[model samples]
Target: MGEPLTIHLPDPESAIHLAGPGEENLKLLSKQTGASLVLRGQDLLVSGPEGAVNLCRRLIEALAYLWGQGRSVTSVDILTARHALDTNRTEEFQALQQDVLARTRKGEVIRAKTFRQRQYVQAVRNHDLTFCIGPAGTGKTFLAAVLAVQALQANQYERLILTRPAVEAGERLGFLPGDLQQKVDPYLRPLYDALHELMDPEKIPALMERGVIEVAPLAYMRGRTLSNAFIILDEAQNTTPPQMKMVLTRLGFKSRMVVTGDVTQTDLPEHQASGLSVAQKILHGVEGIAFCQLGRADVVRHPLVQRIVTAYEGHE
Candidate 1:
């Protein structure tokens, strides 16, 4: 065992901020680094084997950017810090802390919470077309929507179109409800939910009416050249090869498209191939197109959600 390290905080209040709510962040740091941690007054005591102590020290340093500024730390912050230390990408990790993607209507700051998520954001920014494949709760759809909204608000794009394959409802909406939107809304609720998080819910109707924002089933994209738009195709795994090709071809001048899905959770028939999978195989090395694959580690939801994803992966 090495000598215990005593790190002094800027203030007593900052201890609680660094420790996280109920000290969950400290607990996760201890678990990840095998270090003993205790907060007393204004000092943090870390004691363990040499390697573990050093890791804990480095992780705390990496997270200093957040807590030092009085921002509350989260489990996602802890996991990301540990990952940055493990992969020797501490500089990139610090850079991510400064890269806020967007703020919610309620004033919550949104940023990439993992290395892969950062890469995904860069991919969306640098490429005209980007594909992200990941499990649930990895912010695959949310991040895309956030960027899309930011670009739309900045006038970078004339319109924002969010679409997904309505495979569950089979796109047979004529029998369902009132208007075209009301009929299609059941399958498009997730996209709506994402928009609501990024902008005023009350303003969404006005935006939709003015064609500044459009949320619809993937089928609605056919034969239309989507120009000057930022488009997000969510739940893309439900799309067949043809549908995927149709949408890819619809990307018109000055338009950007982000396609996100979890291939493992496809609702397609066993014999049918997921468009996402097929696209990955075919468009992988194509120029001006970027593909990002996020694993269970990229999950930024409740920590339990990461464990649940792992458990299901093991069972599968």
Candidate 2:
């Protein structure tokens, strides 16, 4: 171990925030940087190799920056700080810490956890149309829905539309048991789940009734111009070429569209080509549209899910 180093944090309030609840932040910082840290009053005693000590101090400073901004520092912040420290790129880390995508009912934040995710969110914010392609566990649909809800809540858009290709329906909408709405509701459950993450589940029905929020099967989108709306097309890989063309054309004036899908997970028959795959080729240089491809590193689910995606990707 290197010689002991003492760093005193000036403010008690910031010390609390930097340390996190039950010193979880300190523990994470120590573990992540390979430095042994112990808090004594407002002073932190760090003992490790010189390199490890420097890393710990940098992480502590990063946490202080976030805490000063009233942002909750968690284990995830440690990861971001370490990445920033390693790459010597602190700007993205600072932005990621401050990017408040959405807050859940219990006040948990839902910001981008990775650097690429921050870029993805920025793409969604700046582009009129964006294509997010990634595997499971990436925040493609969820982040798009969060932005859609925030835009609707801020009155940036008059409506929030969520739709997906119900490939399983297979032109049998009438034959599917319940009324038009009920039959398609099952297919759009992912959108419902996303909405519930941003707002109260009870409030969604009233919004849907008022036409402010529309979650429906992709079939209902035909021949309808969606104006002044934030629309998300999930499961685009399941859409046929005609279906993708129809939906893309439905984006009317003052509307933004986000198409999200994992091309590798296409459910279409072996003979059928996924519209998402085809659209990427046709619209490669299209103006006003952006495509963001996220790899296994972008998977924000459980750590094991990231490994699973990476393993599968390696095989491919």
Count clashing residue pairs per candidate.
0, 0
**Model 1, span 1-316: residue lDDT tens:** 9999999999866798899878888898999999999998889999999899998999899999888877778888888888778788889989999898888888878999888999999999999999999999999999999999999989999999999988887767777879988888888888888899988899999999999999989998999999999999999999999999999999999999999999999998899999999999999899999999999999988889999999999999
Task: Give, for candidate 1, the lowest lDDT window spanning 10 residues.
Answer: 168-177
CA deviation > 4 Å runs, candidate 1 = none
What C-alpha lDDT values do all the predictions have?
Answer: 0.92, 0.87
Candidates' TM-scores? Answer: 0.95, 0.85
Tens digits of lDDT, candidate 2, 12-99: 7767777888998888788898899898888889999988998888788876766665556766567767888889888878777777
Best by TM-score: 1
Off by over 4 Å in 2: 6-32, 36-45, 67-76, 168-176
Error of 2 at 38 (Å): 6.1
